[model samples]
Target: MQNKYVNKVLKFLKWGAFILIILIAYTIISARITGADPSFMGYQFKNVLSGSMEPTFRTGSVIQIKLTEKEGTEYEPGDIITFQRDGILITHRIIEKIIHGDAVTYRTKGDNNDGPDIDAIPAGAVLGQYTGITIPWIGYPLGFASSKLGALILFLIPGVIFLVFGVHYLRGWRLSRG
Candidate 1:
Protein backbone atom coordinates (compact mmCIF):
# COMPACT_ATOMS: atom_id res chain seq x y z
CA MET A 1 0.00 0.00 0.00
CA GLN A 2 2.79 2.39 0.90
CA ASN A 3 4.66 1.61 -2.31
CA LYS A 4 1.55 2.25 -4.39
CA TYR A 5 1.02 5.63 -2.72
CA VAL A 6 4.62 6.61 -3.29
CA ASN A 7 4.35 5.59 -6.95
CA LYS A 8 1.31 7.80 -7.37
CA VAL A 9 3.07 10.77 -5.78
CA LEU A 10 6.05 10.31 -8.07
CA LYS A 11 3.87 10.24 -11.17
CA PHE A 12 2.10 13.40 -10.07
CA LEU A 13 5.34 15.24 -9.52
CA LYS A 14 6.75 14.29 -12.90
CA TRP A 15 3.72 15.38 -14.89
CA GLY A 16 3.27 18.58 -12.89
CA ALA A 17 6.84 19.65 -13.54
CA PHE A 18 6.52 18.98 -17.25
CA ILE A 19 3.30 20.97 -17.52
CA LEU A 20 4.79 23.92 -15.66
CA ILE A 21 7.79 24.04 -17.95
CA ILE A 22 5.64 23.98 -21.07
CA LEU A 23 3.47 26.81 -19.77
CA ILE A 24 6.44 29.04 -18.94
CA ALA A 25 8.06 28.37 -22.27
CA TYR A 26 4.92 29.20 -24.22
CA THR A 27 4.38 32.43 -22.27
CA ILE A 28 7.88 33.75 -23.00
CA ILE A 29 7.81 32.84 -26.66
CA SER A 30 4.33 34.21 -27.35
CA ALA A 31 5.28 37.50 -25.74
CA ARG A 32 8.37 37.75 -27.87
CA ILE A 33 6.52 37.11 -31.14
CA THR A 34 3.95 39.78 -30.34
CA GLY A 35 6.48 42.57 -29.74
CA ALA A 36 5.01 43.02 -26.32
CA ASP A 37 6.00 42.42 -22.74
CA PRO A 38 4.72 39.01 -21.64
CA SER A 39 3.89 40.26 -18.19
CA PHE A 40 1.29 42.89 -19.23
CA MET A 41 0.26 41.86 -22.73
CA GLY A 42 -0.52 38.73 -24.70
CA TYR A 43 -1.13 39.35 -28.40
CA GLN A 44 -3.19 42.27 -27.08
CA PHE A 45 -3.43 44.36 -23.95
CA LYS A 46 -6.45 44.34 -21.68
CA ASN A 47 -6.15 47.76 -20.12
CA VAL A 48 -5.73 51.17 -21.74
CA LEU A 49 -3.29 53.68 -20.24
CA SER A 50 -3.04 57.47 -20.42
CA GLY A 51 -5.77 60.06 -20.00
CA SER A 52 -5.49 61.23 -23.57
CA MET A 53 -8.32 58.82 -24.32
CA GLU A 54 -10.51 60.12 -21.49
CA PRO A 55 -14.33 59.87 -21.96
CA THR A 56 -13.44 57.23 -24.56
CA PHE A 57 -11.03 55.34 -22.32
CA ARG A 58 -9.94 56.21 -18.80
CA THR A 59 -6.67 55.38 -17.12
CA GLY A 60 -6.55 51.84 -15.73
CA SER A 61 -8.95 50.57 -18.42
CA VAL A 62 -8.62 47.90 -21.06
CA ILE A 63 -8.79 47.86 -24.88
CA GLN A 64 -8.93 45.15 -27.49
CA ILE A 65 -6.41 44.70 -30.34
CA LYS A 66 -6.00 42.94 -33.63
CA LEU A 67 -2.91 43.00 -35.79
CA THR A 68 -3.27 45.33 -38.76
CA GLU A 69 -4.21 43.04 -41.63
CA LYS A 70 -2.78 43.70 -45.07
CA GLU A 71 -1.54 47.25 -44.54
CA GLY A 72 -4.30 48.78 -42.42
CA THR A 73 -7.98 48.13 -41.84
CA GLU A 74 -10.60 50.66 -42.73
CA TYR A 75 -10.53 53.51 -40.19
CA GLU A 76 -13.70 55.42 -39.43
CA PRO A 77 -13.53 58.92 -38.08
CA GLY A 78 -14.65 57.92 -34.56
CA ASP A 79 -13.02 54.54 -34.16
CA ILE A 80 -10.73 54.08 -31.15
CA ILE A 81 -7.38 52.52 -31.90
CA THR A 82 -3.98 51.94 -30.35
CA PHE A 83 -0.64 52.55 -31.97
CA GLN A 84 2.96 53.02 -30.95
CA ARG A 85 4.32 56.53 -31.29
CA ASP A 86 8.11 56.91 -31.15
CA GLY A 87 8.19 53.62 -29.22
CA ILE A 88 5.59 54.87 -26.76
CA LEU A 89 2.14 53.26 -26.83
CA ILE A 90 -0.88 55.47 -27.31
CA THR A 91 -4.61 55.03 -27.95
CA HIS A 92 -6.76 57.69 -29.54
CA ARG A 93 -9.87 58.08 -31.66
CA ILE A 94 -9.60 58.64 -35.36
CA ILE A 95 -11.10 61.92 -36.53
CA GLU A 96 -10.50 61.18 -40.22
CA LYS A 97 -9.06 58.50 -42.46
CA ILE A 98 -7.33 59.38 -45.70
CA ILE A 99 -7.09 56.70 -48.35
CA HIS A 100 -5.60 57.09 -51.78
CA GLY A 101 -5.87 53.76 -53.60
CA ASP A 102 -3.79 51.42 -51.38
CA ALA A 103 -2.46 54.32 -49.33
CA VAL A 104 -4.13 54.98 -45.96
CA THR A 105 -3.47 57.75 -43.45
CA TYR A 106 -5.19 58.68 -40.21
CA ARG A 107 -5.80 61.79 -38.17
CA THR A 108 -6.37 61.03 -34.51
CA LYS A 109 -7.24 62.98 -31.36
CA GLY A 110 -8.09 62.29 -27.77
CA ASP A 111 -11.68 62.72 -26.76
CA ASN A 112 -10.56 64.96 -23.90
CA ASN A 113 -7.35 66.42 -25.24
CA ASP A 114 -7.29 70.02 -26.39
CA GLY A 115 -5.66 69.19 -29.72
CA PRO A 116 -5.00 66.35 -32.12
CA ASP A 117 -1.71 64.48 -32.16
CA ILE A 118 0.91 66.63 -33.90
CA ASP A 119 1.69 63.76 -36.23
CA ALA A 120 -0.57 61.78 -38.54
CA ILE A 121 -1.10 58.09 -37.90
CA PRO A 122 0.69 55.99 -40.45
CA ALA A 123 -1.77 53.53 -41.99
CA GLY A 124 0.60 50.67 -41.35
CA ALA A 125 1.22 51.69 -37.76
CA VAL A 126 -2.27 50.92 -36.53
CA LEU A 127 -2.45 47.83 -34.34
CA GLY A 128 -6.18 47.41 -34.57
CA GLN A 129 -9.50 49.07 -33.91
CA TYR A 130 -10.76 48.93 -30.36
CA THR A 131 -14.18 47.29 -30.51
CA GLY A 132 -14.82 48.10 -26.87
CA ILE A 133 -13.30 49.39 -23.66
CA THR A 134 -12.77 47.48 -20.42
CA ILE A 135 -12.10 48.64 -16.88
CA PRO A 136 -9.29 46.75 -15.21
CA TRP A 137 -6.04 47.44 -13.35
CA ILE A 138 -4.32 44.39 -14.82
CA GLY A 139 -2.01 46.57 -16.88
CA TYR A 140 -0.32 48.05 -13.79
CA PRO A 141 0.75 44.68 -12.43
CA LEU A 142 1.83 43.51 -15.86
CA GLY A 143 3.96 46.65 -16.23
CA PHE A 144 5.75 45.73 -13.01
CA ALA A 145 6.60 42.26 -14.28
CA SER A 146 9.57 42.24 -16.63
CA SER A 147 10.98 39.80 -19.14
CA LYS A 148 14.09 39.36 -17.01
CA LEU A 149 11.90 38.51 -14.06
CA GLY A 150 10.01 36.08 -16.27
CA ALA A 151 13.24 34.43 -17.35
CA LEU A 152 14.31 34.17 -13.73
CA ILE A 153 11.02 32.57 -12.80
CA LEU A 154 11.19 30.24 -15.78
CA PHE A 155 14.59 28.93 -14.73
CA LEU A 156 13.84 28.92 -11.04
CA ILE A 157 10.63 26.98 -11.33
CA PRO A 158 12.27 24.18 -13.24
CA GLY A 159 15.37 24.14 -11.07
CA VAL A 160 13.35 23.87 -7.91
CA ILE A 161 11.15 21.19 -9.36
CA PHE A 162 14.03 19.19 -10.73
CA LEU A 163 15.86 19.35 -7.41
CA VAL A 164 12.81 18.15 -5.55
CA PHE A 165 12.10 15.46 -8.12
CA GLY A 166 15.70 14.32 -8.17
CA VAL A 167 15.70 13.83 -4.45
CA HIS A 168 12.43 11.96 -4.47
CA TYR A 169 13.29 9.84 -7.48
CA LEU A 170 16.65 8.89 -6.02
CA ARG A 171 15.05 7.81 -2.78
CA GLY A 172 12.51 5.68 -4.63
CA TRP A 173 15.19 4.07 -6.75
CA ARG A 174 17.30 3.32 -3.71
CA LEU A 175 14.40 1.67 -1.94
CA SER A 176 13.60 -0.46 -4.96
CA ARG A 177 17.25 -1.52 -5.39
CA GLY A 178 17.47 -2.48 -1.72
Candidate 2:
Protein backbone atom coordinates (compact mmCIF):
# COMPACT_ATOMS: atom_id res chain seq x y z
CA MET A 1 0.00 0.00 0.00
CA GLN A 2 2.80 2.41 0.83
CA ASN A 3 4.60 1.57 -2.41
CA LYS A 4 1.38 2.03 -4.36
CA TYR A 5 0.82 5.44 -2.79
CA VAL A 6 4.40 6.46 -3.59
CA ASN A 7 3.91 5.40 -7.20
CA LYS A 8 0.69 7.40 -7.40
CA VAL A 9 2.40 10.51 -6.05
CA LEU A 10 5.31 10.10 -8.42
CA LYS A 11 2.95 9.70 -11.36
CA PHE A 12 1.06 12.85 -10.37
CA LEU A 13 4.27 14.84 -10.13
CA LYS A 14 5.53 13.57 -13.47
CA TRP A 15 2.32 14.61 -15.22
CA GLY A 16 2.39 18.00 -13.51
CA ALA A 17 5.93 18.61 -14.66
CA PHE A 18 5.09 17.52 -18.17
CA ILE A 19 2.14 19.92 -18.35
CA LEU A 20 4.17 22.79 -17.01
CA ILE A 21 6.96 22.13 -19.48
CA ILE A 22 4.53 22.04 -22.37
CA LEU A 23 2.98 25.34 -21.30
CA ILE A 24 6.38 27.00 -21.04
CA ALA A 25 7.42 25.65 -24.44
CA TYR A 26 4.24 26.94 -26.01
CA THR A 27 4.73 30.41 -24.53
CA ILE A 28 8.32 30.67 -25.75
CA ILE A 29 7.51 29.49 -29.23
CA SER A 30 4.51 31.75 -29.48
CA ALA A 31 6.55 34.75 -28.37
CA ARG A 32 9.23 33.99 -30.94
CA ILE A 33 6.69 33.65 -33.74
CA THR A 34 4.44 36.55 -32.81
CA GLY A 35 7.20 39.22 -32.79
CA ALA A 36 5.12 41.11 -30.25
CA ASP A 37 5.71 40.82 -26.55
CA PRO A 38 4.67 37.51 -25.00
CA SER A 39 1.28 38.28 -23.54
CA PHE A 40 -1.62 36.42 -22.00
CA MET A 41 -4.90 37.72 -20.63
CA GLY A 42 -3.98 41.35 -21.36
CA TYR A 43 -0.63 41.17 -19.60
CA GLN A 44 2.59 41.44 -21.62
CA PHE A 45 5.90 39.87 -20.69
CA LYS A 46 8.92 42.10 -21.31
CA ASN A 47 12.57 41.67 -20.48
CA VAL A 48 14.46 44.79 -19.54
CA LEU A 49 17.62 44.86 -21.62
CA SER A 50 19.08 48.13 -20.38
CA GLY A 51 19.40 50.20 -17.23
CA SER A 52 17.57 53.13 -18.79
CA MET A 53 14.63 52.58 -16.47
CA GLU A 54 16.86 52.00 -13.50
CA PRO A 55 15.61 52.91 -10.00
CA THR A 56 12.26 51.82 -11.42
CA PHE A 57 13.19 48.63 -13.26
CA ARG A 58 16.68 47.21 -13.37
CA THR A 59 18.39 45.50 -16.23
CA GLY A 60 17.66 41.76 -16.53
CA SER A 61 14.27 42.21 -14.86
CA VAL A 62 11.17 40.63 -16.31
CA ILE A 63 8.22 43.00 -16.23
CA GLN A 64 4.55 42.25 -16.62
CA ILE A 65 2.60 45.03 -18.33
CA LYS A 66 -1.12 44.92 -17.79
CA LEU A 67 -3.45 46.67 -20.17
CA THR A 68 -5.45 49.29 -18.39
CA GLU A 69 -8.48 51.20 -19.72
CA LYS A 70 -9.54 51.15 -23.36
CA GLU A 71 -7.17 51.97 -26.19
CA GLY A 72 -7.76 55.72 -26.39
CA THR A 73 -7.88 56.44 -22.67
CA GLU A 74 -4.94 54.39 -21.44
CA TYR A 75 -2.13 56.81 -22.25
CA GLU A 76 -1.21 59.82 -20.17
CA PRO A 77 1.83 61.77 -19.08
CA GLY A 78 3.96 60.13 -16.33
CA ASP A 79 2.92 56.71 -17.55
CA ILE A 80 5.67 54.26 -18.44
CA ILE A 81 5.07 52.89 -21.89
CA THR A 82 6.83 50.61 -24.31
CA PHE A 83 7.24 51.77 -27.88
CA GLN A 84 8.90 50.62 -31.08
CA ARG A 85 11.78 52.68 -32.36
CA ASP A 86 13.96 51.59 -35.29
CA GLY A 87 12.60 48.05 -35.03
CA ILE A 88 13.54 47.81 -31.36
CA LEU A 89 11.25 48.10 -28.36
CA ILE A 90 12.05 50.87 -25.89
CA THR A 91 10.35 51.47 -22.55
CA HIS A 92 10.28 54.93 -21.00
CA ARG A 93 8.21 57.33 -18.99
CA ILE A 94 6.14 59.93 -20.79
CA ILE A 95 7.33 63.38 -19.85
CA GLU A 96 5.01 65.33 -22.07
CA LYS A 97 2.22 64.90 -24.56
CA ILE A 98 1.89 67.10 -27.60
CA ILE A 99 -1.25 67.42 -29.66
CA HIS A 100 -0.91 68.81 -33.15
CA GLY A 101 -4.17 69.02 -35.08
CA ASP A 102 -5.42 65.43 -35.01
CA ALA A 103 -2.19 63.72 -33.95
CA VAL A 104 -0.93 62.90 -30.47
CA THR A 105 2.76 62.72 -29.68
CA TYR A 106 4.74 61.94 -26.52
CA ARG A 107 8.04 63.10 -25.15
CA THR A 108 9.66 60.19 -23.30
CA LYS A 109 12.72 59.79 -21.16
CA GLY A 110 14.36 57.03 -19.21
CA ASP A 111 14.59 57.52 -15.47
CA ASN A 112 18.36 57.18 -15.59
CA ASN A 113 18.82 58.95 -18.88
CA ASP A 114 20.51 62.33 -19.01
CA GLY A 115 17.73 63.95 -21.02
CA PRO A 116 14.47 63.29 -22.80
CA ASP A 117 14.55 61.49 -26.12
CA ILE A 118 15.34 63.75 -29.07
CA ASP A 119 12.43 62.65 -31.23
CA ALA A 120 8.76 62.74 -30.33
CA ILE A 121 7.02 59.38 -30.10
CA PRO A 122 3.78 59.20 -32.02
CA ALA A 123 0.84 57.57 -30.34
CA GLY A 124 0.87 54.76 -32.89
CA ALA A 125 4.31 53.67 -31.73
CA VAL A 126 3.23 52.98 -28.17
CA LEU A 127 2.84 49.31 -27.29
CA GLY A 128 1.39 49.34 -23.79
CA GLN A 129 1.78 50.99 -20.42
CA TYR A 130 3.67 49.26 -17.63
CA THR A 131 1.56 47.91 -14.78
CA GLY A 132 4.30 48.12 -12.15
CA ILE A 133 4.71 44.36 -11.89
CA THR A 134 8.27 43.07 -11.99
CA ILE A 135 10.08 39.82 -11.43
CA PRO A 136 13.75 40.41 -10.89
CA TRP A 137 16.50 38.36 -12.53
CA ILE A 138 13.99 36.36 -14.57
CA GLY A 139 15.05 38.26 -17.70
CA TYR A 140 18.46 36.56 -17.77
CA PRO A 141 16.95 33.16 -18.45
CA LEU A 142 14.31 34.62 -20.72
CA GLY A 143 17.00 36.45 -22.68
CA PHE A 144 19.02 33.26 -22.93
CA ALA A 145 15.97 31.37 -24.20
CA SER A 146 15.70 33.91 -27.02
CA SER A 147 18.90 32.58 -28.55
CA LYS A 148 18.96 29.45 -30.78
CA LEU A 149 21.56 27.61 -28.70
CA GLY A 150 19.85 28.52 -25.44
CA ALA A 151 16.50 27.31 -26.72
CA LEU A 152 18.08 24.04 -27.83
CA ILE A 153 19.53 23.50 -24.39
CA LEU A 154 16.25 24.44 -22.68
CA PHE A 155 14.33 21.93 -24.82
CA LEU A 156 16.90 19.15 -25.08
CA ILE A 157 17.66 18.82 -21.41
CA PRO A 158 14.18 17.66 -20.55
CA GLY A 159 13.88 15.57 -23.73
CA VAL A 160 17.14 13.71 -23.10
CA ILE A 161 16.17 13.03 -19.51
CA PHE A 162 12.83 11.61 -20.52
CA LEU A 163 14.38 9.52 -23.26
CA VAL A 164 16.92 8.04 -20.92
CA PHE A 165 14.26 7.18 -18.36
CA GLY A 166 11.97 5.68 -20.97
CA VAL A 167 14.76 3.48 -22.26
CA HIS A 168 15.68 2.36 -18.77
CA TYR A 169 12.08 1.55 -17.94
CA LEU A 170 11.60 -0.41 -21.15
CA ARG A 171 14.78 -2.36 -20.49
CA GLY A 172 13.66 -3.25 -17.00
CA TRP A 173 10.26 -4.38 -18.24
CA ARG A 174 11.85 -6.54 -20.95
CA LEU A 175 14.22 -8.19 -18.47
CA SER A 176 11.33 -8.88 -16.13
CA ARG A 177 9.35 -10.50 -18.96
CA GLY A 178 12.31 -12.70 -19.93
Candidate 3:
Protein backbone atom coordinates (compact mmCIF):
# COMPACT_ATOMS: atom_id res chain seq x y z
CA MET A 1 0.00 0.00 0.00
CA GLN A 2 2.83 2.39 0.87
CA ASN A 3 4.59 1.58 -2.36
CA LYS A 4 1.46 2.25 -4.40
CA TYR A 5 0.95 5.64 -2.71
CA VAL A 6 4.55 6.60 -3.33
CA ASN A 7 4.24 5.71 -7.01
CA LYS A 8 1.09 7.81 -7.36
CA VAL A 9 2.79 10.84 -5.77
CA LEU A 10 5.83 10.45 -7.97
CA LYS A 11 3.69 10.22 -11.10
CA PHE A 12 1.85 13.39 -10.19
CA LEU A 13 5.08 15.26 -9.67
CA LYS A 14 6.52 13.94 -12.91
CA TRP A 15 3.60 15.22 -14.97
CA GLY A 16 3.71 18.59 -13.25
CA ALA A 17 7.37 19.02 -14.04
CA PHE A 18 6.80 17.92 -17.63
CA ILE A 19 4.13 20.55 -18.14
CA LEU A 20 6.34 23.26 -16.66
CA ILE A 21 9.19 22.30 -18.96
CA ILE A 22 6.96 22.40 -22.01
CA LEU A 23 5.74 25.88 -21.10
CA ILE A 24 9.27 27.17 -20.72
CA ALA A 25 10.33 25.64 -24.01
CA TYR A 26 7.38 27.17 -25.80
CA THR A 27 8.06 30.63 -24.39
CA ILE A 28 11.68 30.54 -25.54
CA ILE A 29 10.88 29.24 -29.01
CA SER A 30 8.01 31.62 -29.63
CA ALA A 31 10.04 34.64 -28.60
CA ARG A 32 12.86 33.66 -30.94
CA ILE A 33 10.49 33.18 -33.84
CA THR A 34 8.29 36.23 -33.31
CA GLY A 35 10.95 38.83 -32.49
CA ALA A 36 8.72 40.12 -29.75
CA ASP A 37 8.02 39.25 -26.18
CA PRO A 38 5.30 36.66 -25.73
CA SER A 39 2.46 37.44 -23.43
CA PHE A 40 0.45 34.96 -21.41
CA MET A 41 -2.92 36.11 -20.14
CA GLY A 42 -1.95 39.75 -20.72
CA TYR A 43 1.27 39.47 -18.74
CA GLN A 44 4.81 39.31 -20.08
CA PHE A 45 7.79 37.99 -18.14
CA LYS A 46 11.12 39.78 -18.43
CA ASN A 47 14.52 39.26 -16.87
CA VAL A 48 16.45 42.14 -15.32
CA LEU A 49 19.87 42.30 -16.96
CA SER A 50 21.29 45.29 -15.07
CA GLY A 51 21.39 46.98 -11.65
CA SER A 52 19.60 50.12 -12.87
CA MET A 53 16.47 49.24 -10.96
CA GLU A 54 18.39 47.93 -7.96
CA PRO A 55 16.90 48.36 -4.47
CA THR A 56 13.50 48.05 -6.18
CA PHE A 57 14.48 44.88 -8.03
CA ARG A 58 18.01 43.59 -8.27
CA THR A 59 19.83 42.30 -11.30
CA GLY A 60 19.07 38.66 -12.19
CA SER A 61 15.51 38.99 -10.97
CA VAL A 62 12.50 38.11 -13.09
CA ILE A 63 9.64 40.61 -13.30
CA GLN A 64 6.11 40.46 -14.62
CA ILE A 65 4.90 43.27 -16.89
CA LYS A 66 1.23 43.80 -17.56
CA LEU A 67 0.50 44.43 -21.20
CA THR A 68 -1.84 47.29 -21.99
CA GLU A 69 -3.09 48.94 -25.14
CA LYS A 70 -1.16 52.10 -25.92
CA GLU A 71 -4.19 54.16 -26.86
CA GLY A 72 -6.19 53.86 -23.68
CA THR A 73 -3.52 53.26 -21.11
CA GLU A 74 -2.72 56.19 -18.84
CA TYR A 75 0.74 56.60 -17.35
CA GLU A 76 1.90 58.85 -14.52
CA PRO A 77 5.16 60.05 -13.06
CA GLY A 78 5.48 57.32 -10.45
CA ASP A 79 4.62 54.34 -12.63
CA ILE A 80 7.31 51.87 -13.65
CA ILE A 81 7.03 50.91 -17.29
CA THR A 82 8.87 48.75 -19.77
CA PHE A 83 9.70 50.16 -23.16
CA GLN A 84 11.64 49.17 -26.25
CA ARG A 85 14.55 51.39 -27.21
CA ASP A 86 16.89 50.47 -30.07
CA GLY A 87 15.68 46.85 -29.98
CA ILE A 88 16.28 46.42 -26.25
CA LEU A 89 13.74 46.41 -23.47
CA ILE A 90 14.31 48.79 -20.56
CA THR A 91 12.39 49.15 -17.33
CA HIS A 92 12.33 52.48 -15.55
CA ARG A 93 10.12 54.83 -13.59
CA ILE A 94 8.47 57.77 -15.29
CA ILE A 95 9.93 61.03 -13.94
CA GLU A 96 7.86 63.42 -16.01
CA LYS A 97 5.24 63.55 -18.73
CA ILE A 98 5.56 65.98 -21.62
CA ILE A 99 2.54 66.88 -23.66
CA HIS A 100 2.65 68.55 -27.04
CA GLY A 101 -0.88 69.13 -28.29
CA ASP A 102 -2.08 65.57 -28.97
CA ALA A 103 1.37 64.00 -28.63
CA VAL A 104 2.82 62.67 -25.39
CA THR A 105 6.27 61.61 -24.21
CA TYR A 106 7.78 60.35 -20.99
CA ARG A 107 11.01 61.17 -19.20
CA THR A 108 12.14 58.03 -17.38
CA LYS A 109 14.83 57.30 -14.81
CA GLY A 110 16.08 54.19 -13.09
CA ASP A 111 15.44 53.98 -9.39
CA ASN A 112 19.16 53.80 -8.56
CA ASN A 113 20.33 56.19 -11.25
CA ASP A 114 21.55 59.73 -10.69
CA GLY A 115 19.67 61.41 -13.52
CA PRO A 116 16.81 60.89 -15.92
CA ASP A 117 17.46 59.27 -19.26
CA ILE A 118 18.76 61.52 -22.02
CA ASP A 119 15.96 60.95 -24.52
CA ALA A 120 12.25 61.25 -23.95
CA ILE A 121 10.36 58.08 -24.90
CA PRO A 122 7.39 58.45 -27.19
CA ALA A 123 4.17 57.04 -25.82
CA GLY A 124 4.00 54.47 -28.56
CA ALA A 125 7.36 53.00 -27.53
CA VAL A 126 5.96 51.89 -24.19
CA LEU A 127 5.42 48.15 -24.01
CA GLY A 128 3.77 47.63 -20.67
CA GLN A 129 3.69 48.65 -17.02
CA TYR A 130 5.61 46.73 -14.41
CA THR A 131 3.36 44.59 -12.23
CA GLY A 132 5.64 44.59 -9.17
CA ILE A 133 5.75 40.81 -9.12
CA THR A 134 9.36 39.65 -8.99
CA ILE A 135 10.98 36.26 -8.54
CA PRO A 136 14.40 36.95 -7.08
CA TRP A 137 17.51 35.24 -8.51
CA ILE A 138 15.59 33.04 -10.95
CA GLY A 139 16.77 35.02 -13.98
CA TYR A 140 20.19 33.33 -13.96
CA PRO A 141 18.73 29.89 -14.60
CA LEU A 142 16.16 31.29 -16.98
CA GLY A 143 18.82 33.10 -18.99
CA PHE A 144 20.80 29.89 -19.29
CA ALA A 145 17.80 27.84 -20.33
CA SER A 146 17.18 30.16 -23.26
CA SER A 147 20.53 29.30 -24.81
CA LYS A 148 20.93 26.38 -27.26
CA LEU A 149 23.37 24.37 -25.15
CA GLY A 150 21.49 25.06 -21.94
CA ALA A 151 18.16 24.00 -23.45
CA LEU A 152 19.66 20.75 -24.71
CA ILE A 153 21.00 19.94 -21.27
CA LEU A 154 17.75 20.94 -19.66
CA PHE A 155 15.69 18.49 -21.71
CA LEU A 156 18.39 15.81 -21.94
CA ILE A 157 18.79 15.36 -18.19
CA PRO A 158 15.09 14.80 -17.68
CA GLY A 159 14.84 12.46 -20.65
CA VAL A 160 17.64 10.25 -19.32
CA ILE A 161 16.17 10.19 -15.83
CA PHE A 162 12.75 9.19 -17.14
CA LEU A 163 14.20 6.49 -19.33
CA VAL A 164 16.10 4.96 -16.42
CA PHE A 165 13.04 5.06 -14.18
CA GLY A 166 10.89 3.43 -16.85
CA VAL A 167 13.34 0.58 -17.32
CA HIS A 168 13.60 0.01 -13.58
CA TYR A 169 9.84 -0.04 -13.21
CA LEU A 170 9.41 -2.48 -16.09
CA ARG A 171 12.00 -4.85 -14.60
CA GLY A 172 10.26 -4.77 -11.23
CA TRP A 173 6.89 -5.47 -12.83
CA ARG A 174 8.22 -8.42 -14.83
CA LEU A 175 9.81 -9.98 -11.73
CA SER A 176 6.58 -9.62 -9.79
CA ARG A 177 4.61 -11.29 -12.62
CA GLY A 178 7.06 -14.23 -12.72
Top TM-score hit? 3
Put down candidate 3 lDDT per residue, 1-178, tens digits, no spaces. 9999999999899899878878977876787899867678889989999999999999999999988676513899999999989989999999999988888899999999999999999888898999989999999998998788988998799789878988998999999999
Model 2, residue 24: displacement in angstroms?
A: 1.7
Q: What overall lDDT goes with each candidate model?
A: 0.74, 0.86, 0.90
> 1-178, model 1: which lDDT tens digit per residue?
9999999999899798688777767876887799765442324554666778777667776666655566665677988877878887778889988877878888999988999889888878887767674656666654544447856775787789789978998999999999
Tell me the alpha-carbon RMSD of every candidate. 5.1, 2.8, 2.4
Candidate 2, residue 39: the lDDT equals 69
Per-candidate TM-scores read 0.64, 0.82, 0.84
- Which stretches in model 2 have alpha-carbon errors above 4 Å? 1-7, 67-73, 168-178
Scored by lDDT, model 1 comes in at 0.74
Best by lDDT: 3
Clashing pairs in 2: none
Steric overlap count per candidate: 4, 0, 0
Q: Please say which candidate is ahead in TM-score: 1 or 2.
A: 2
Number of the candidate with higher lDDT, 1 or 3: 3
Put down candidate 2 lDDT per residue, 67-131, tens digits, no spaces. 54453334889999988899898999999988887788899999999999999998888778898
